[model samples]
Target: MSKYWSEAIQSLTPYVPGEQPKGSNIIKLNTNENPFPPSPMVLEAIHQFDTDRLRLYPDPDASALKLSLAEHFNVKANQVFVGNGSDEVLAHTFMAFFRQPQPLLMPDISYSFYDVYCNLYGIEAKHIPLQDNFCIVLDDYAQANGGIIFANPNAPTGRALTLEKIEALLQRNTETVVVVDEAYVDFGAQTAINLVDKYPNLLVIQTLSKSRSLAGMRVGFAIGSAELIEGLERVKNSFNSYPLDMLAQATAIAAIKDNDYFVETTQQIITMREWTNQQLQSLGFKIIPSKTNFVFASHRYIEAAELMGFLRTNQILVRHFSRPGINNHLRITIGTEAEMQAMIDCLKRHPDIISL
Candidate 1:
């Protein structure tokens, strides 16, 4: 809207992040952040970081973090890339592989930021609609495309495609890059990381935000062929060299190394997600089969926005997207056991909901 803006900026429709309430009283099941704190190892590492290191620039390649991720995922250091967050990693991805003469293909109801990135980069996008059940069918992407990307245990819907399905797509689509955004993969879904060595065109991007409880830290990484990693590095160096700082690198290494804590916390969310689904279904809500740390549900009678308002008034927050096809559904992040019980108990006691 400014006269000084570039043509790309002028035409862009930006992504809107979930609301972060200012108060401490609300049960925040809106943003899909972990209900638990990060691993003790990560916290200890942060506390022990030397302050004097701030005077020196961080490794431009984030070599230490990459090596840690490489070890954790059983990939080589040369095949990994790190960034300030997955959002940045995704932005760099769109710039590097998706901007092409042919349109990039993605699910119509997947991550909203994909659209923003496409607009920002002037990349043509073809939205392949999800089935009536809200699951992606890769066969729909048979048309020619510059590249392909979609979330596994997809956002908002929380439905995941099995690794078998993903590998099937990779087998047929050998000419273009396939990026699987696995931000929520740890909760219950199988990761496509294991298939990377077999499919050189596959790139699996994951973050510490959801399962590792590191949203505050803003770290994300990608695993792929060394050649693909090099392409991302070329694009990253042209944009920002110091994407991950020293403290971020240190803490990320600690988080990745704490395999036991990572497994324990993600299992906790998975257990709570199933319980929440049962609770919602008992209340006459149609719950989608979810593989992530959240559930997507629609009440049989109550409208989504109205239910969101009702929850908000009671000091609870969940996400509701007003877009078509999914406007009736609410995406609720799985909180602690007590938080989930409190939300269900509130609905049980409220006269308006009880009467319905």
Candidate 2:
């Protein structure tokens, strides 16, 4: 460690993102990225952008992008807040709402970034364990907490909570803020955006990266009551006046306007996810019932780490978490039909997998 490093910097166990392979021929499935290209409308928006304005800074507030998002979600302009990515919005959220006297409550096996953020901000966190089947138990969250946040169609596990369960939590736990990270909501999950108007404390965060296929554009937004949005804005402007760039703003607008394409692509993912689940089950892998674009599964006999290594050798990349209780499971992203078949074929040829 460098002597100049501050105590806080030295202590932080930074979040480790999924590996991005250097080769082009690799079937990259570790990160939950959309298999299809972005909408044609989004491409046209980029082509038509006025490049001469590169010298000028983009809209600091991202007003137009916010307007498009508001229209898409049926909310007003002030109710939306845009950022560089959902991760950035999540960072601002931790600073604005999660830092408090009471401990922040979240699932034990959740998006690892939540724990990283809590440690980064010096917030106390209480982890509620998921049920044996890797399902988040909501009743565990009702006791007391400074704040609560979880991914809808949750990451890694890909299990989701319904609107009814979310509202029930809201009805009783009204004292503190509640954040629903809906990064994969478009894939076979209901949104909590409608409940935002009824529950002032609820905030819904979403990204164009998943369904709209704009991960490269780096656009994410939060929908909440005007007051909560204002709070996020205060934190954002204090840290960085402009988080979204000019191109990002334009890309997000076009992606939002093309609702038909978004629907078609997400439906395709949902369909593929179920198909992959069946394929994996046929090979004796116990798969979780996933509503997201990825499926989490563990083989009945083969070790996940060994399988991951074998797949990596075959130029196929899938995510395997070594965390306690889930060390044997692999989180595989749903790719195109051809890519999925290639993966299945590769697995079928595995010597050990073939024996089973």
Predicted model with the maximum TM-score: 2
Query: lDDT per residue, candidate 1, 1-356, as tens digits?
Result: 89899877887788999999998989998999899998999989988988888999988877778888898889999989899889999999999999889999999999899999999999999999999999999989878999999999898899999888999899899999999999999988899999888998899999999988999888999999988888999999999889888888888899889999999988988999889999889898999899999999998988989888888899999999989999999999999999999888876765566987
lDDT of 2 by residue, 1-356 (tens): 77899878888999999998787999988999999999999899999999999899888998889888888888999999999899999999999999999999999998999999999999999999999998888899987799999888778899988999999999988889999999998898899999999999999999988888998989888999998999999999999998898999998899999989988999999999989999999998999889888999999999999889988999999999999899999999999999899888988988988887
Which residue pairs show collisions in model 2?
none
Candidate 2 structure lDDT: 0.92
Q: How many collisions per candidate?
A: 0, 0
Off by over 4 Å in 1: 350-352
Return the top candidate by lDDT: 2
Worst 10 residues of 1 by lDDT: 344-353
The TM-score that candidate 1 achieves is 0.98
Model-by-model lDDT, in order?
A: 0.91, 0.92
